[model samples]
Target: MQRPNVVLIMTDQQRWDTLGCYGNEVIQTPNLDWLASEGTVFDSAYSPSPSCIPARACLLTGMDPWNTGILGMGRGGERHMGIGFEHTLPGELAKAGYHTQGVGKMHFYPQRSLNGFHHTVLDESGREEDPRFTSDYKQWFERNKTGEYGMTDHGIGWNSWMARPYHAPEFLHPTNWTVNESLKFLKQRDPSKPFFLKTSFARPHSPYDALPYFFELYMQKNLPKAQVGEWAAMHDVPKDASSTDAWRGVRSDEDIRQARAGYYGSINHIDHQIGRLLSYLKGSGLMNNTVVIFTSDHGDMLGDHHLWRKTYAYEGSAHIPLIVKLPKSMGRTVERTDAPVLLQDIMPTVMEAVGLDIPQTVDGKSVIGAMKGRSAEARDFIHGEHSTCYSEEQEMQYVTDGRVKYIWFPRIGTEQLFDLSSDPYELTDLAQRPEHREQLAAWRQRLISVLEPRSAGMTDGDRLVSQAGKPFVKSPHYAERLARFPLPF
Candidate 1:
């Protein structure tokens, strides 16, 4: 049989429970829901770093954060620093005679770094860090010549909690443009070669501005309220209630409602665009020969536990949705597994599915076995961490195996444990409970063993050490890459 076409569809900072397949009833994600129904869902997927740059680095290289050379959000000026990888997902596939193309937000430095794709049509969300950077979406928006409304004309800051209807028309929305470009690629792709295309969306991260119709769709519905943990009083009080972009603070009911409305609306809108893409694939008779995977770089906190943004070890930030739809020729049945999977697994999974060799440099194992219900033990657990992003106290190292999660705050030397099976929202902290002491200690030791091998001074081989928090530090490999491919800025 011919190698199946690969299409990776990703959304930025989306939560695991935001789709109907994940028990989100209020949101209209029929397209994704159908995909999940017919495919296999990894119910306990996570982002290793729980932020954009680092998580995406893992996806591209199929390596953990330590190997990816990105710890947290890059360093001070390193946010735009380029990453060097000897083997990339698209690059490896391209070598196997697949036509590789990427559309939408790559979030790469110099903005246009293709990494491995044969071609890319970018939309970096109006980010012009590089002087020569101009996204194809931005260029199209300009050339179409409609009105004075710019992409940010909605007046929403990129990472703000502010919510509103997109001031521009629906056709001009970046989500629409992303799908349109993907459909165009499908239409004109090389007929003789299998294709690997990544279609990424920038919304559901922030600037929570959906089209007016979608905004109204959820505004009229009763959205779920944000759940705060019993031990989360430290973040319940607003450090800056007046700031629209505050990362941690108590938000009013109306504020949280509006944000959820816009957020849910944006997800629903993206789902509709996905429907459009799926429709095209079916009409073109390419659906049966294609492998479709859906996931996100990371998840948004979305006011959960009074936290507003990402980079935390909490489920709201780290947990993500992972669904894989194999082609009809594979004859796979609908399946769901609670195995702990990460973004890095995608690269090897795609490689295995297309009959390519998994690169030696990759740290992630292929999940094709899990997709076929052949492997239930993907990993014992997942260790995730992030350097200080919003505050020193927020720096965390966590371990989870889907049923429970243990988080360690190095700056404060505090620990929190949650039983995710019973309390998926993490409403209670079990770290201090007497009966759960052994469980907590076991999870803590799991993290300690994982960190002991690193030179980041996180562990002393015997126990975790507390320290004053500092800005993120780049790994040696990352530093070398930045030096070789120094940013023009």
Candidate 2:
């Protein structure tokens, strides 16, 4: 059997419900919708850790964040520097006689470290502070764009929720560049062997730089209101008039609405680019042999719960779209599955698809069996956690099985339980309800079971014990961030 080629397309900070296939009544994601109609959609997929480096590290290493040894954003001091991964997707596939190419935002430390891809074209997006920082997209922008322009030359802050159209031409956007580069790779790749290509997007993240047409499309629609739980009221107040608040702040309803407009626009723009990639594949006859997978590293809050960014245990920050399209010859077709899965599963699933080894080090199970209509849950519950980004309260952990979620804040010893089956929006907290006490306790026991073995001092004998100073940076990785090594640039 000829091994199938692989095209793994991922988005940054994109939510689960933004696509037309995900029960989103308002948004129009025609390309992604078409992909979903033809592909196998993992309806309950999530990132184990809802942050960039940690989540992506899981996708790259096929291990949970704990085993991958990247518990926080891989930045800051020596120990906080780039990833120290044991294995990588491209690295493994390249060993299996596949030509691998990586394009766009890897978010890996030392910026340019091509972990496993045979070669790469990076678009790290004005991230000059990274150790080995050079952006292929920026260079292309300089060469092809009519005038000198900062990517964020528009009045929007890099992390702002402000909505605005891109200042440059649409082709100059990194999303288009990602597609263009992948197309170039398709034309130039080694034709003798199977290929594993990854095209990752850096947008819909922030600065809300959607193309004008896309921005206008969502701005004109009757958008859904942001979910504001009664529990979210305390942190919902705007701290300042400014749109960019690193920490929790009050944002106006208008501000959130406009932010949603930009976010949806960004999603539309990415979807269009995916269409371009798909068209190229179909035209080039690769469609018959290539398996296409679409997903995001993590999700954006998009003003959900008054929270604007990721690292939260909420569905807004954790839930993501997972669409996998097997080759036409596979004779297997399922529009969607309710099976709970994670981004880490991509590693072993792709390995399984290409007839490669599924390593023992991988914490994720391959979903190939389930994709082929085999009975497998993949996981009973996914363990997710992230260290503090801005406040001590941001230090949290969670476990969920699609219908229910248990959130624990170890520092303050706070807990939230949501029955997603009835309250999909998570508007009410059932933790304090007497009727749900046993269920709450059972969820807490699950939390204890997950935390006790980690040695992070978050638990003691089946009970959560708050530790002093809040070990925001998990160790070994924490110690590495404290140590020193020469940077790339």
Candidate 3:
């Protein structure tokens, strides 16, 4: 039998509930919904880390962030370590005689120019210091740095210029150039051999850039607002919960509603682009022989718990959309056994789909049997970790059995236990409650038992050294700031 082509479509900062199929009526994601119907949708998929780089590193390598050493944001630290192009999915696929290519944002740093893919089309532009990309907007403030004229800063204002131009589609944004490039590659690639193509869309991420049509679509609807009363009560949340500057100020009911509407608009915009890509694949005669997997790196906090970005352990940030479409065996979409799964499973699953050997170095298990409707043992628990961003301040670990979630924040000496079955929103913390102490301790012991063995030489604060023998540059600003505001851990 011939190997099936692999088309992995990933979006950045996309939440699990954004699709029409995921019980969301506000946003229209027809393509994603159709894909879900045609494939097995893992309702509860999660990223090991909520951040972009770390989560992506975990995706490509099938290893946890600690093992891969991609602990923080773009272009620093263990990134320089020799883990480059060698261990990536493209690298592995290339060895298996597949043509590998990537388009759009992979966030593999050194400007996405490295990596072993046969082709790379990077569409990211703008000054590196853009505030929309980081927490400190002031650091990127430069009067001379200008782009297509848009809004400017509004001093201490809640609903100001920052919120205008509410919707921009992924393709029209600078990153869209990468998508166009991918289209070109798809149109021109060799048709004889199987290919591994990753088309990533970077939108709904920040600056909330999208075309006017998407903006107009949401403008017609009255969006929902953040529940401020519910949010303020969450102040005791561990500081490292998904870091974002968007939720800093106290917002009125109307402001939160508009913000959520804008976020939905961004999601819809990406959905349209995905629809276009899927249509192209079908029209080009590539749909029948291809295995398509659609998912996201992590999720955004779009006012969930009043948080605006990833890094939190909440379902809004941890749970993601995972849909896999294999070539129909008898014109049927097989439903796999209901079980917990992790993003790490992707690498081996792809290998299995292509009949390749699962590498010992990869930590994920093959889900090909499950995808094919064959019964198989499923993962009992999924593990997730998030360390200090920019700075090594807060460290967190999570283990979940799909029904209960256990989180440990070592730096702050805080723990969170959520009975997902009862409280999916994670509004209440049961870690300190005496009645739940036994369950919490059991979860902690399981977390430690799983982690300690995997971490042979790993340390909480150890820097990952590159293959070239250079150490990762921990963000200088973050280190300095940590020294200033020492949290009581």
Off by over 4 Å in 1: 74-78, 469-474, 483-489
What digit string (tens of lDDT, one per residue) describes model 1 on residues 1-489?
679999999999998999999888899999999999879988999999888888998899999887777778723213443746789999998988899999999998868778989999998886888777789998998877478768787788998998999987789889999999999999899989999989999988899998999999999999999989988789865555568888888888899999999999999999999999999988988888898999998898888888887998989999999999888777774479888999999999988887788999899988878777765647899888787777778878899999999999887889999999999989999999999989988998999899877776777887888865554544677677667766655
Residues 198-229 of candidate 2 have per-residue lDDT tens digits of: 99998878878889998888889999988989
lDDT on C-alpha atoms for all candidate structures: 0.87, 0.81, 0.65
Q: How high is the lDDT of residue 233 in model 1?
A: 83
TM-score-wise, the better of 1 and 3 is 1
TM-score of model 1 vs. true structure: 0.96
Candidate ranking (TM-score, best to worst): 1, 2, 3
Candidate 1 local Cα displacement, residue 488, angstroms: 4.7
Winning candidate number (lDDT):
1
lDDT by residue for model 3 (429-463), tens = 78878999889888877677666544432223222
TM-scores for all candidates?
0.96, 0.94, 0.80
